[model samples]
Target: MERLINIDNGGTLTDICVWDGEEFSFTKTLTTPFDLSQCLFDGMAKASTDIFGEEDLPRLLHSTRHIRYSTTQGTNALVERKGPQIGVLTDSPTLAEELRTGDASAELFDDLVGSRVAVIDADRDLEELSQDIVRQVNRLTTDGAARLVIAMADREKERTVKGVLLRKFPRHLLGSVPILFTWEFTPDAVRGRRVWSGIINSFLHPTMERFLYNAEHRLRDHKVKNPLLIYRNDGASSRVAKSVALKTYSSGPRGGLEGTKALSSAYGLEHVLMIDVGGTTTDVGSVKNSTISTDRRGSIRGVPVSFAMSNVHSSGVGGSSVIALRNGVITVGPESVGAAPGPACFGFGGKQATITDVNLLLGVLDPDTYLDGGFSLDAQRSRAVITEVIAGPLGISLEEALIRMEAAYFERMSTSFADDVVDAETTTVAAFGGAGPMSACGAARIAGVRRVLVPRMAAVFSAFGIGFSDIAQTYEANIAGLSANEFAATKTRLRERATRDMFQEGHEIGECRLEWSVVQEDAEGQLLSEDSYSESDPQPSASAHHAMLTLTARFELPHASIPQAEATEKSPAVSSSTRNVRSTAAQVDEVPVFDLDTQKAGAAGAGPAIVEGPYFTARVPQGWKFDVTVAGDLMLTDTIEN
Candidate 1:
C-alpha cells in the first residue's frame, strides 16, 4: 500500500499521522527538546507499529511516499527569549529620535531589539563609516552577539554598506562573523520592520538548520528517496534548503488552520472558527467563504515581521496552563509548565496546579484511559495540588475550586475569541489539538457558537493537514512606483525564479500549478486590495502615484491524490458506559459516553453526552445535540429551549 507520513511537533508532544491509501492511524510521543529527531522517529515508529503490527523503521521510511514535518519550536524559542544574541546597524538616526517622539515605528523597533544587542549608526560617508562599522562589529562580538544585521532606510545605502562590509571582512577568513542585509529579504519602506524581520530570522536560523538537516540526513540514510518537506507558516510545504527560518514560525498552528479549511470545504461550511488547544497555548483562526484569512505582515509575540502567513491569534490558555491564586485573584495563566514537568498529574516533578489537574479532579478526563492507556495519571496528586494551591488560598471546597478554575479558564478563552475572532455566532467551531475537544463545549457556549465539528483524527489534525498540503513556494517583489508594463515585467521575473526553484527541487514546470496576485496598499500603508494580476488590465496614469504594490507568485508541486470518503450505512451508536461530567451550567450528571471508533456513521444523540476517542474527549453539554455524519465527523448543534 502507498503511504504518506506527516508529523507536528508541539511544545509538549509530537503527533504523527499516517495515511496508507486506505486507512489512517495516528500516535503521539513526548517531545525531546534536546534532540527533536528522537521524538520524530518515536512517534513514527509507534504509529507504524499500531498500523502494520511491527516496529520496522527502515521499511516504514523507505515505503512512505511523502513525509512532511511542522513544529512550534521557533515560536516557543522566540517567546522564551532563547535565541542567539543579535546586533543591528541602521543608517536612520530617526529611529532613536522617533522613540523620544513616541512614533509607532520606534515602538515596534523597541520590541524587536532584545537584550545583548546594540544598534550603531552607519549613516556617514563610506570612508568614515567603514572604520565605525568595524569598531561596532568588534564591540558587538565582544558583547557576545554572534550575528549582525545591517538595515539602512535607503535601499541603495543598504546595498552599498553590505558590499563594503563583505569586502572588509570576507566570510572565507577565520573568525569572520556572518552579516544579513535587511533589503536582501524584504525591500519594503518600513525599515524598522524590515530590520526586525532579518533579526528574527537570523536568531532562528542556526537551530532550525541543524535539526532539519539532521533529520534529512537520517531520512537519506534510511533509503528514503524523496526529500523531506518542511511545513511553512503560509500553509504550504517546501524543501528544507529552499525555506527560510521566518517561514517556519508558528507552522504547527498554521497546519491546524489549513486542516480546518479543508474540512470546511468538504462539509460545505462557508464560515468556521478553528481553536487549537495544545500543551502551551490555544491558537484561534478563521475561515470565511472557504478561504483561510492571512496576514501579510505577520507577527511573533506581537513583534511584526514581513511575512505572509495564516492569521492565527494565540493565548496562553491550554491544558498545561498553570492555575493559581495571586493576591486573592484567581489566575489561569500567561505561564505554562510545558512538556517537561508538564502537570502535577503527569508525576514528572511538577508541583503547580494546571488545567489538566482541574480536569482530572472534575472527572472530565478518564485517568484509566488517558493517552489510550499508554500512560497513567495520578488523580490523587492532582486533587492534592488543586486543594493546596487553589482551595487553601480561597478557603473554598475542592469541588467549588474546580468549578471556579474552569470558569476562569473558559472566560479567558471566550474573551480572547470575542476580541480577535469575527462573527462567532455564525461560525462553526472546528476544535482540534490534544485538549481542544475537552473544552470545546464550554468555550462554544461562551462564544455564542451554535455548531461544532470534531474531525475523526482531531488529535493529530495538524499532521493530517500536512498530509494534504502541496510542495509550494511564494515569492514577493516590491513595486511602489511601477507602471502597468513594469508590474507585468516584475511578475514575469518572479514567476521565472519560482519556476526555476521548483525545477531544482525535482518538480517539472509542466506538472506544476502557478498563480499570481498583486497586493496594493494605501498612502498610510494599510492594505487596500489584493487581486489577481492580468495582462489585459488598464495602465495606471502617471499622475496617480500608488503607495506600494506587491507581486506574489505561488507554485504548487505535484502530490498524491487523497481518497474521498465512501458512503456507508449508519449503525446504532453504542455507549460504552456513563460518567459523571460537570457542566458549565452548574450541574453534575451522568453523561452517556460513546467511543468514536466503534460508533457508526448514522449514530445520533442529544446533549449531556461524552464522545471519547483515542486522543481526545468531547463533552456535549445539556443544550446541544450531536449526529455522526456519513464521513464520520461528529456534528454538534445547539438545541432550542421551549
Candidate 2:
C-alpha cells in the first residue's frame, strides 16, 4: 500500500490528509505554534489506529510511503520578528551604503546601523584585516548574531571567502558558524538582487533550520524513514537536510500553486486564477499555459526577495477572522482569533462574529454538523449573536446584514483577486482552503471570472501538493560579467552543484535540465516599453513586460552585461528606459527514484466519502469525477459530458 502523509496548517485549523493506496483518510486539529508537528503526529496516530487497528497502527505508520510538510513558520518568523540577528559583510563601505536602506540587506540586518557592523572589503590584503575581523565578529557575537553573511565585491569570490575568513577568525570561534556566502546564496550576476537573496537566506535560515530539525526528529520517532521535504516559493521541494532549508518558508502556498498548475494542465485550462483561502489569509496567484507567474523578488511577509515565484498576494481575509462593522461599514478581518479563541461558531468562547459565523447564518455552513460531525456548531446561538451584535447595530434586518456581510466579504476577495489575474484574460478560479468553496462561485462571479475548479479534497489540496512535491534545490552564481558562453558554463556548474547537493540528501537523478533566460532593460531611468527587446518578443506579451518593468524600475537597478540581441532571442523582451540589461539564468533539476502518480481511484465515493482515520471527507459534487493517483493527488472534475 502506498501510504502518504500530508499536512496543511491554517490559521485556526491544521488539516492532515493521508492516502493509503486503497483509500484516503483525513483529520483536523487546532494549529499549535509551539509544536506544530504535534498535530501531525496526532493526525497520523488517529489515521493509524482507525485503519490498521490499534495494535497494527505502529507497524502501518512506520511504513508510511511518503511524508510531506506545509508550514507557516517562516511567514510567522518575519511577521513576529522571532528570527535571530544576522551580520552582513560588504565589498566596501560605498557598496554597503547602497544597500543600507530600501534593500533586502537592510531588512536582514534589521538596519541597526553601525551596531553589529559590516566589514568593508576594499580589494585589500586579508592579513592586514585579521584582527579587525575578529573584533567585529566578537562584537557581533556579543550583540546576538547567531549567523553571518558575507557578500563580496566581486560576487564570484563569494565562495572563496571560506578559506580567507577561516584563516583570520579561525574555525573555533566562527568555525561552527552559520556562514552564508553571496556567491553560494545567489551566484547570478546582479549584485543588488544577489545581496537581497543572501540577506533573506542569512536572516531566515537559522530559524527554519532549528524548526525543521525539531520537526524531523519528531517524525523519526514515528519510525518513518522517509525524509521531510522543504517546499520552495518557486513551487519545488528539497530535502530538509539541504543547505537551502530557508526555501521551506515558501512551501505552504507554493504547493497550492503547483496543484493549480497540475490541475489546469491536465484539464486543459490555459489561464487560471488560484485562490487559496486559509485560516489567516487568502493568497491569490495566476497561471498561464500552466506556468505560474512570479515577481522578480518573491514576497514573504511583505518583504520583496531576490528569488522569483508565482506572483501571490496575501490578504487578511480568512475563515477565522473576526467579522464586524467599523465606521458603519462591514469589515471582514485583518485580525484573527487564531487557534486558541477559535471562532464563536466553534463553541470555543469566541464572542466576536467571525466569517464562519456569517457562513453559518447564511445556511451555507451547518455548525451543528460540520467537518463530518467531528465538531458540532450551534447555529441558533450564532444567529442570535449575529442579529444582536451585527444586525441591530447596523439598524438592518438579520437577513439584510447577513446578505450585506457576505456580499462585502466576496467583494473584498474579488477585488484583490483582480489585481493578480489582470494579465490573464481567460482564467478559471481554483478554490481551496476551509471556506474556499463556500464563497468560491460567488467570489469568481464578482471577480468577472467564469468557471470555478474545486478539486477533490479541496480544503486539503495544500497537503496533497506537499505529498507530491519533488526534492529539488536552486542555486544562482552571479556571472553578470561573464559572456554568453560563460553564462552557459555557469548554468552547467549550478546544475552540477544542485545535483550533488541532492545526492547528499540520498536522492539520485535520472534526467536534469537547466532553464535560462536573459533579462534586458534600458538604463535605470528608461522605460522598458522604449527598449528594443520589449518591442520584439511575444512570450511575456506587452502587458506582462510592462508590469515587470513597472515593478523593477521602482528599485535602483544595476547594469546587466550580456551580448546584444542574444537577450532578445533567449528571453521575453522587457521594456526599460535604461538601455543597460543584465544576463541571468535559473537552473532546476529533479532527483531520481521518488515516485509520483497523478492518476486516481476508479470511482468517486458516495455521500461526502469518509475514507478513514480522521474526520475528513471529499464532498464530491453531483456529476463530479474523483480519483486518487500515483502522485497522491486527488483529482475531481466536472465529468458531465459536454
**Candidate 1, residues 1-642: lDDT per residue as tens digits?**
658789999988899988887677889899999899889998988987887799887778878877889977777777765677776776665554432233543443454443434454556778887887777777777767777877777778888778777777777751645678888887655655676688889888877888999999888778788888889888778889988898899898888887888888777787988888888889989888779888867766666677777888898888898988999988977798888989999999889998889888777788888888779899998988988998988888888899999888878777656664466566898988888888787777777777888887788888887766777767776776777779778767776887788887677655666665566655434566676655355543322222333333334433323224455565557899999877643668787889988877778888778888878888787788887876677888888532
Q: Write the per-residue lDDT of candidate 2 for residues 89-134, one digit (tens) a residue.
A: 6656664556555564465445422355567553556664555566
| Minimal lDDT window, size 10, model 2 | 551-560
Candidate lDDT (C-alpha), each:
0.77, 0.60
Model 1 lDDT, residue 446, Cα: 79
Give the TM-score of each candidate: 0.91, 0.75
Candidate 1 local lDDT, residue 436:
86
RMSD of each: 3.3, 14.4
lDDT of the structure predicted as candidate 2: 0.60
Best by TM-score: 1
